[model samples]
Target chain A: MNPNTAWLRKTVALVILIGVWEACADLGYFDPLYMPAPSKVAVALFQLFAQGTIWPHLIATFSAALGGLVVGLVVGTVLGAVAALTPLVGELLAPVMISLNAVPRVVLAPLFVIWFGIGVGSKVALAFILVAVLIFFTVFTGIRDVDRRLVERVITLGGGRGALLREVYGPSVIAWILGNLKVAVGFAFTGAVVGEFVAATKGLGYLLSFAQSSYNAALMLALVVLIMGFVLLLFGLTGLLERRLLRWRG
Target chain B: MLRVDSLALAYGATPVLEGASLEVPSGKFVSLVGPSGSGKSSLLRAVIGLQQPLAGVIETDIGAGDIGMLFQDDALLPWRTAEQNVALGLKLKGVAAGTAIASARQWITRLGLYGLSERFPRELSGGQRKRVALAQVLAREPQLILMDEPFASLDAIVRARVTQDLVRLVELRGISVLLVTHDLEEALALSDVVYLLSHGPRARISGRYEVNLPRPRDVIKARSHPDFAPLLQRLWNDLSREVGERAA
Candidate 1:
């Protein structure tokens, strides 16, 4: 299908679902206070904007996600590269990553909050934890699975370690990095939202918790929609960057 | 001239070439025809430092040009353009980008990729990619080119075209070429001298033939010659026996 038509189809499907939700609420099949209609959520979103209360939460969530993604990406890539290029390091660290990765990162958010407090620091730290293992495995596998002949070819051409890393390893791992980003970007928002839910003074997660406690279903739905929109925006940008960087691979 | 004296090349305990010896005269095409595992590739690898001989001296008497290798698989980088792949040799020589690109394009044209310089290896057909690979080594202006089963992947028609292209290019350049193939016809078709390699604990040069075949030798024309059938049969018998013994 054409990309435009595919996108239009998705939009129409979402509109139909919203129409059903509105009709159900209107007929009293569901309590509007507990399960707000799409219309109620939209009005709640406008009210939040008018009150100027959503900006701080949006900024807080964006900051945590971006900061964590940057740190995780840098450190993960380096660590993964070192593991790939050096056998000793890979062996030493293999078990540690396996064990840590097996544990749900959400299980550690409370620990982060306890240690770093209910601040941006805790949320950022939690997001980093969420993204690091995924990035590391992707990049390490990227480097490890490089073409053996290409490496030998480079060596034959008088290329040293630096050149092998630059030409062969860089190109080989780029695909893996992009593949993992599809998952890791989502994890970044997840880390932020979950961190906010557990303990945070300001953020979408905090709003989610407040909405639940105050029995404001519309506010909660509105915040959830806003967070999903933000995540989708970031995902789209990552895809754009992946396409640009990987154009030559074709 | 090159000499492999008292060479011992093996994989673990299994010897591929033991006490092997060879002498290749300069500026001539020498084809190594042998069974699949008769140390043909090992000899080439050892010469290029891809493998180390247990005992031997691979002496290059006249070494002005860098060694150019055409790998068994073509080995073209998947991400490189036809032009970029050809420019690899020049890149190793540290040529400026403009000069390197121009030189690469010149040889690429000669190698029959005139309009497809910007296409990647994956984009080209098998024969076209092989020609691009040929251009890669030719652009290096090497004193000697070691080709390992370079044309094995091409169909009969494309292979014939590439062989002629190689002959014309070799004639113009006068570079020494060592073409390795299991195909006896290809060996006789291209080389000035053909060395039939025996299976090894020592792979010996069992027999040698001097083609002295005229320029522009066609694959079709060569087959019609009186000597072609006899030559083909001889290689079949020799290489097959060697392979069976190794398998046994």
Candidate 2:
């Protein structure tokens, strides 16, 4: 398929779907209270942005998610390297990391809120746990899965432990971490949003809760669209980063 | 310069190599040829210290850090450029970055891979990648080189060219080599001494031949030497006998 035509087809399909939804709502196919018209959601989205009511919420969520992501990545990489390099540490940390990975870490959001008191700390904590566990596993497996032949080659080339880590394990871990960055970003946002949803002063999730209590379906859908758009934007950025960092793979 | 005395190797209860002994005198090129599963690669791994021997001793005057090894598969790091890959050993040894890269570039050019220093392994063709791997090994200037059929994957023409380059480099540097190969012709053309290993289960040295071929040999043209064909036939018969014994 031609790239331009493929994109045109996607836009046409999305436009048609929205038109159908609008037509159904206008024809009273569903209750307006539960399923608002697309136009109504769009208007709500416009009002929130034009009135600037979402600025504080957007800033709050963005900072919390970004902060958590950076911290989680650093901590996870350090811990993963330590585990992979030292046999005793690897054995000691394996069960703990495995158990943490087994659970849906998002469920801990409410407890984090209770401890950190509905501030950015709670959201950051939730996002940190979510991303750290994921990146930890990625780095750990990445190092372990390196080709044994490559390791032997490096050794026979007079490389020692430090050289092995720098030349072999280090690049392998970077690729794994970047490859998983998309999921980590999603998890970070999920953590921030879910924490706010459970309890928070100002965030997209807090607005969602408010929309829920008032039964404002149009506003709720608007916020959902906003959140999805932002996450998709972040996903695109991470993909570009992955391509740049792993250009050697070509 | 290198000697393996009654080396034994096994995987659990299954013996792969038994009582295998060989020697590579300084500045000599030695080859080990064997049938499939006859522990030729296992012996090379043991010599390089990648695999521990079940029993016996390996003695060498060269230190561990002075050894270089080439594999059948190109083991260049995917993330590093050809030049950087060649410079890795120098960098590890604390050679300054500029000097290391300059030396790497020189070796890369010497291997007929000029102007491809910036290409990654994935971007290079199989033959070019093999050349880069050779440069990576040779740039280190190792005193002892171990090869495990390093040219088996290349086309015949490319293999002959690489063999010529390798012979020139090894001779110019006076490096000792211990090669593992299944090709009797390749062994005859490149090695001063060729050892035939018996079929596995308990593989051991079955025969040894000394080739008094002149130095500065051309790998492809050397096969046309009067003595080459007869030596290859003798090695081939010994190898077939080992295979026949295994089947019987």
Candidate 3:
């Protein structure tokens, strides 16, 4: 469990896997047309970046994902707070939200394309739906789950409605939202890519579809690696924010 | 000053207290001691406006804002720092940020938690968290304070020390306190007047004893006082009889 040894073990495992993969491809264990070696994928990744062919797709995807995340967070927080604080609203909305959540959100991508057209708008809308549902449930439950004792303490201190929200429910909800940011990020990305796959002029998902049509396995795997990198970067940023905001949990 | 008369408290049809009454005079420490499930906490809750008394008259010269309460569980906000927790009441009262911070700092320092102002409740020990809770209540500068077994969770030595510090602070500020606890010795050590409540179905004030002990009494050493044993024995006799009767 030593940090250094853990890091070394992970590195060795990855290296061995890639070595075996390269050996199999070089020995022609599989057709290169369908399965490219790790080296070919790496070269394709380098060329895609060096030739700047990936910039537009990357930017399109990033913008759509970021936009959806922001919109979802804001709208979900408002709805969740309303649902938690008002019983009538919760009674009216809870079942509707549950039904929406039960449906496979990905299936909505084609309908969204038909509604919003094959552009960033459709992708943004899809991502918004995905992230909003997640954040709504989390914030709603978090607010409701705030310790009643803490609320009573605040009221005894002469705190009013605003104070209850600010001091008691606000921090609790924020903590819950931050705790689930990793999942939210992944869902947002999935929403954007799925929307693009159904219909889009530009984006990593569009490029992936194009690569599939051409049967260029190296390019397809290269795009897959690129998407993973983007998701990882977002995940890392969210982690940093989580640590800073939840330092009290230490 | 707080006065409750002919108080009847119940949850739905189940009666918890009936004809329970007590008074906390200005600048006096009063304790309510009783067996468990004797409706002590219910009375405190009714007084604090967290619950409604089925029928009672609670008269107080102080406004709700001028009264502070300490919960049995400390109830410190887990996400806020010690200083921020103390500053909460001030902020709620519309005190300026700078003044609230300054006052919070002073209270934290006075409670011997100066360097720990930035620590969260989870990062603090049980004793340290209790001190922070005390600081939080004291910082509000309430004319009257209500405590529901605030130090019940601490060890004997820590509880004694906290009680001493609390007494000194309340005395210095001339704040009246109404404390509820099951610990007979704690009640006798800290209060000028102790009211013992009988066991429930309809708990009522069964007896009252005045501790003629002087002010600034050392709660730890006060037990060894010549007058301490007899008062303790008398209260215990009344309380144990109620408990035994209830068990039967």
Candidate 4:
């Protein structure tokens, strides 16, 4: 639990991962044509960056991911808040959400492609479908977990419905919402990449699919890492905002 | 006057208060003293309309002035400033923004929190939070008040100070209170009358004693008051005896 120990522990994990990858590559258990070495992946990333191919794919995927995140956040928050406060709506929507969650969103990609075309719109739409449910479940559980004791305390002070929501439930649920926002963004990013892979004219996922068709294994790995890096950047920024929201908790 | 008549209260199916009746006149600070699970809190909850009395009449005659209830932890909104939390009740009653907020705010200053208005609940200490809650309640200018062990969470010194401030505030506002507490000295120190509740499947008022001690009374000095020790000893003995009798 010590701060210094945690830093060292993370360093050890990174070293171990790289060490294992290098050892596997040196052993030649797998052919380099099928599985590129990490150094080759790094070289492919540098080559893509030099040719200015990485930036366009980065921009394409980032747009889809960010758009999906925004739509998911707004719609999910509205649904979650409404569902938590109103039992009838909650009961009606609960089953529908479960079914939606169960359905493979990839199966709907072709439908989205037909509806929105093979552009960013189709990708964004597909991502939204995937991300919205993650946000809904997290935020709903957040509101549900609010302390009943605190609500009673507010009510006994003669707080009306709106006041109880504002003072008791809203503040109480912020920690949950923010905690889930990070994971929700990750889900949204995953949805975006999956959408791009299914049918996309451009994006890191498209680049990945294109590289695999050409048997450019290192380029595919580079594109995969780049997408993960983009996800991490957005995720890190959200975490910063989360820390601000929870400063009151400290 | 507050009338709790023929009250039958319960937590789910298990009954707690069976045919309980008590009358609290306006402008008196009364304490309900009891052992644990004696329906003191349940009675307070029933009075506040938070818990239904199952089958009884809890009548409130005065309806004009705003009412306030204070809990042990103060329960201030962590995101709100001291002044904003204090003025929340005014906002809740659909009070006009300009006038209600302006009038509601002067109390924080009057109650020694003049410049600390913008500080959030997390920034304040335990004693300061209690003061904020007190200011919050006082800002309502309630004719009737209810407290569920408001000062029980404070240390002895802070409790004494807050209790003193409370007595002064009550006198200034002429607020009628029905307080629930397990602290006998606290009950004796602040109450004009004390009602003792005994524990059971159906808890009832075991004894009612008039606290003849003069205000503004302090607990340290209360023990030395001519009637204090005897009253304390009597309540203590009765409560112990009741518990023992029940155990047997």
Best by lDDT: 3
Candidate 2: where is the Cα deviation over 4 Å?
none
Error of 4 at B118 (Å): 3.7
Q: What would the C-alpha RMSD of candidate 2 be, to one decimal place?
A: 1.6
Cα lDDT for residue A216, model 4? Answer: 92
- Candidate 1 — which residues are off by over 4 angstroms? A1-4, B62-65, B199-204, B216-220, B244-248
TM-score of chain B of each: 0.91, 0.98, 0.97, 0.94
User: Whose DockQ is higher: candidate 1's or candidate 2's?
Assistant: 2
DockQ result, candidate 4: 0.47
The share of true interface contacts that also appear in candidate 4 amounts to 0.56
Lowest summed lDDT across 10 adjacent residues in model 1 chain A is found at: A151-160
What ordering of candidates by TM-score runs from best to worst? Answer: 3, 2, 1, 4
How far in Å is the alpha carbon of A131 misplaced in model 2? 0.8
User: How do the residues A6-52 of candidate 4 rate in per-residue lDDT, one tens digit apiece?
Assistant: 97999999989978887898799668998878888899999988988
Model 2 chain A weakest 10-residue run by lDDT = A149-158
Candidates' chain A TM-scores: 0.95, 0.96, 0.98, 0.90
**lDDT of each residue in B1-248, candidate 2, tens digit only:** 99999999987789999999999999999999999998999898888888899998899999887788889998999999999998987787678999999999999998999989999999998899989988877887788899999999999889888889999999889999999997899999999999999999788998999988899888888899999999999998888888887898
Estimate the overall C-alpha local distance difference test score of candidate 1: 0.83
Better of 3 and 4 by DockQ: 3
If both were scored by DockQ, which would come out higher, candidate 2 or candidate 3? 3
Candidate achieving higher lDDT, 2 or 3: 3
